[model samples]
Target: MTKPTETGFSAPEFLTVDEAAALLRVNRKTLYELIRLTQLPGVLHIGRSIRIRRDALLAWRPGNGGPALGESR
Candidate 1:
């Protein structure tokens, strides 16, 4: 059974870089850069792979005080 998320909808608990990038309408490289800079939250590093929590992504917004996308920290 699918569980309701904080966003009031059901989504995958984790998202791959490509999946996340698509959702954010950004390039995969840009997403990687955000992850590398530790700007985006809820990043999980599993071996050589990376995963992002859907709830965290849904909660994130530029107005939340995070750096603007593509801006250097």
Candidate 2:
């Protein structure tokens, strides 16, 4: 979950690529492909590492009558 700080910036709960892939029920490679296609939410790059927000992954359900992670609200 993300928490609002005194500076008004949110600190989102970030998950590793492997963890995110497991939550999406897809392999890591597939998740990477989705990220590449812009269908999935983009990763947060911290130096040489990448991370995804857990909330975004939870919101990404296709055919659920709602927009996906990176879609416009």
Candidate 3:
């Protein structure tokens, strides 16, 4: 069973690129770059669309040890 996140989304919930970018407070381009580099986790390709798992997105940290959340990158 999936647990509910603070946003009321279940752990298994999928978020669009816009939604995921908004949650991370980053621009869509940045998110897309991460996707392009295969840095982001839980990325799913459905047809020509993309979906990211809410849980995986929330748990992700910059693999390169980039700036902390809420700080300028």
Candidate 4:
């Protein structure tokens, strides 16, 4: 698990749909498509937003995983 620095930013973190999409470098729709296909991992559906755990993303691929915004197969 990752812990936040003094600035406070780390794993188990929360990101907006747009932010997550950006992290994956894809558009929001594409991200949704990935979610629809169940290709992305560790995505949580909160009341109104789709969230991905930062640690999960990091572990999936160290130093930037490939297009992980979408759900995983």
lDDT of 4 by residue, 1-73 (tens): 4577767766436666687788878798987876776666778988876888765654654335445554453
**lDDT scores for all predictions?**
0.86, 0.75, 0.84, 0.68
Candidate 2 per-residue lDDT over residues 45-73, each given as its tens digit: 79988899776777866565645544666
Candidate ranking (lDDT, best to worst)? 1, 3, 2, 4
lDDT of 1 by residue, 1-73 (tens): 3468778987788999999999999999999998988888889999999999977987988464766767755
C-alpha-based local distance difference test score of model 4: 0.68
Q: What's the TM-score of every candidate structure? A: 0.74, 0.61, 0.72, 0.60
Which residue runs of candidate 2 sit more than 4 Å off their true CA positions?
1-12, 63-73
Top lDDT prediction, candidate number: 1
Candidate 3 lDDT, 1-73, residue by residue in tens: 5678779876647889999999999999989988876779999999999999988998987764765333555
Ordering by TM-score: 1, 3, 2, 4
- Write down the TM-score for model 2: 0.61
The CA lDDT at 47 in model 2 is: 98
Clashing pairs in model 1? none
Alpha carbon lDDT of residue 43, candidate 2?
A: 69
Model 1: residues with Cα > 4 Å off, grouped in runs: 1-10, 63-73
